[model samples]
Target: MSHLVRSGAWVAGALVAGVSLAACAADSAPRPIDESSPAPDASEVDYRDGEYAATGWYGSLPSHQDVALTIEDDIVTEVTITTPAEDPTSLQHQQAFADALPGEIVGQQIDVIALDRLAGASGCSEGFMNALAEIKTRARA
Candidate 1:
């Protein structure tokens, strides 16, 4: 019926308008970085932490990255990242990779990082893995 058709059109238009308005009101601000955070002290780091290393290779990716993690008494004490190949325009991806792991992993021990369930920036999960691997290697040495 004509009445039903008109009601449907009106409902669709309202939904579209509401969605656009919501998108416009979203916060587009960049996340803040704390440069003042203290560096990991060797004295505080447990050199005898368990050695763990892993590499994440995705597809035919030409580049390589490395991550190292040191765990002492079931706690993560150190993490470092090395990049041999990096995409030029991927700064946000790089930072996300750096910030996601260390702060949380510092006092925890785990066999693997939960990459799939990461809140956002899955693209940098590979980089995070590299850093974890590097920590493992360095700790062993």
Candidate 2:
């Protein structure tokens, strides 16, 4: 009976040690980020051919802007901007700004450096630039 109790205690100790080691191993393993999470900032982006998107806000009113870019051979083939504003006037302004983006942005390399405001979309432009940086980070091959 004493021998049986001793053997049981030894087994329990071994089981606890095994579980502790497994927990330590799991804690040390690197966890992957979810796909929806924002990408980390990357310098000198080498874009893989795919569509990338990002969102940003600007100014006191804080209009939301979403920018999506389609890349082919490291060149921006298409650019789309969606700005949802609270006020009607703001919406119109944002829409016009979004409309002008393709003309200015298309045919350029994915590395957007100097985005200028056009057609009263200065605030949206700032948001667009911020989103562009995020897009570049995700574009790295």
* C-alpha lDDT of all candidate models, in order: 0.43, 0.63
lDDT of 2 at 11: 21
lDDT of 1 by residue, 30-105 (tens): 8688779966554454345554444343324433334455566646665543333455534444445555556656
Q: State candidate 1's TM-score.
A: 0.44
Which candidate gets the maximum TM-score versus the true structure?
A: 2
In model 1, where do residues sit more than 4 Å from their true spots?
Answer: 1-54, 117-119, 126-141
Cα misplacement distance, residue 21 of candidate 1 (Å): 42
TM-score of each: 0.44, 0.64
Q: What lDDT would candidate 1 get against the real structure?
A: 0.43
